[model samples]
Target: MNPKVKTGISAAQTGLKAVKIGKKALNLKKKLPGEKKKATQKALEKSAKKAAKQEQKTEKKQSCRQRNRRALKNTKGIGRIALAIWNRYF
Candidate 1:
C-alpha cells in the first residue's frame, strides 16, 4: 500500500531484468573453423569479460538511483512531519 514499498519493488524488478538481459546477451555460441578456434575463443572470453564489467557498472548505477529515491522519500516524510509540528505549535 505504501508508495515507498512500491518503488522498492519496482527497483528490485528492474535490477533483476537487467541481470537477466545481460546473461542472455552474453550467451555466445559461434561455429568457427578448426584453425581459428583458439583465437575466436580468446576473443569471446575477452568480450564476455568486458560485457560483464559494463553490466556491473549499470547495476551499480541502478542501486544508487534506488538509494537516492529512498532517501528522498524519507526526507520528504520527515519534512512533512516537521511542518505539521511547526504549524501546530506556532
Candidate 2:
C-alpha cells in the first residue's frame, strides 16, 4: 500500500480503538456543566408537562361541573310546569 493510504488506515484503526476506551483525551468540554444543564432542562420540561396536565384536568372538571349546573338550572322551569300538569291530572 502507498504510505498515505497506510497512514490513513492506521489512523482509522487507532481512532476506533480510542473510541472503545472512552476517548477521554478527545473531550473538548468539561463534563459537569453540560450534564448539569441537561439535567436541569429535563427537570424543567417534566415539571412543565406535569403542570400542564394538572391544569387540563382542573379545566375539564370545572367545565363539566359548569355545564351540569347550567343544564339543571335551564330545566327548572320545565320541572315546575311538569309538576303542575301532574297535579292537575291527578
Error of 2 at 62 (Å): 1.4
**Model 1 C-alpha lDDT per residue in residues 9-81, reported as the tens digit of each score:** 7667666765765554445323556657666656766766676677667767777887899999999999999
lDDT measured at residue 4 in model 1 versus the true structure, 0 to 100? 64
Stretches of model 1 off by over 4 angstroms after superposition: 1-35
* lDDT per residue (tens digit) for residues 1-33 in model 2: 454575466557655654643343223223446
Give the winner by lDDT. 1
lDDT of 1 at 86: 100
Local error of candidate 1 at residue 1 (angstroms)? 14
User: TM-score, each model?
Assistant: 0.55, 0.55
Query: Candidate 2 — which residues are off by over 4 angstroms?
Result: 1-32
Clashes of each: 0, 0
> What are the RMSDs of all candidates, in order?
6.3, 23.1
